[model samples]
Target: MKQLYYAALIYLVLGLAGGLGYREITKANGFTGDTQLAVVHTHLLVLGMLVFLVVLLLEKTFTLTDSRLFPWFFWVYNAGVVWTAAFLAINGTRTVAGEPTGAALAGMAGFGHILLTAGLVLFFVCLRSRLSTSDTAPTTTIGR
Candidate 1:
């Protein structure tokens, strides 16, 4: 749970930084055209920060860490988000600098998407396994 909190915090900071970096870099370079840099900021915020925060809540409710695949999901998902965002940032920077874009960046970014997909699958599988085995139904203790 704490680990999830920290991950969310880290991604929140990274996302904010990515956005600021994009703004400053583009402004400095007089770049007015669309670039992959903006996507990097969004991805870090949505997939990185928001997803982790939601996962933290799910963990509190479902104890997802108890699953064998939870650790794998955690690491792989984070790696994918970072990998994709990094390449996007690099491509954006290159675009802003008026440099030629190439196939290698696209390939690397594609792999990151694959990793994110696999991690999402793992999360669902873990959640399903837990729900299937849970004998206790959800009960309200709000008034108690």
Candidate 2:
């Protein structure tokens, strides 16, 4: 949980910094044609920061620490997001600068997507196990 919290904070910084950095790069370079770099910040926020934060909070509602899959999901998901963001930055800059993106970058990005899908499946599996257990304690019980 602490690790996840730290990861989320890191992503928050990365997302904000990435957004500002990409924006300044475009502005300074007079890039008005294609701005795929625009999504750099969004991807970090949504896939990295937001997802981790949600998982951390879910830990409070459910015993995520007990799961065999949560740790794997956490690491795999972060790796995929990082890989995807790196390529997004690279290809986005290339596109904005009117350079050709080679096949290697595209292949790497596709691999990242595949990893992201696998991580999501693990997350869902962890969530289903927690929900299916009747002995699981509710963080907020409403009924009297």
> Which one is best on lDDT?
1
* C-alpha positional error of residue 79 in candidate 1 after TM-score superposition, expressed in Å: 0.5
* Candidate 1 segments whose C-alpha is farther than 4 A from its true place: 136-144
| Tens-place lDDT digits, model 1, residues 20-96 | 99999999999999999988889999999999999998888788999999999999999999999999999889999
The candidate that achieves the highest TM-score relative to the unseen native structure? 1
TM-score of each: 0.93, 0.88
Clashes of each: 0, 0
Q: What tens digits encode model 2's per-residue C-alpha lDDT throughout 68-139?
A: 998888888888999999998998888877889999988898888888999999999998888777365555
Pairs with steric clashes in candidate 1: none
What RMSD, rounded to one decimal, does every model reach? 2.3, 2.6
What's the lDDT for all of these models? 0.91, 0.87
Candidate 1, 114: how far from true, in Å?
A: 0.6
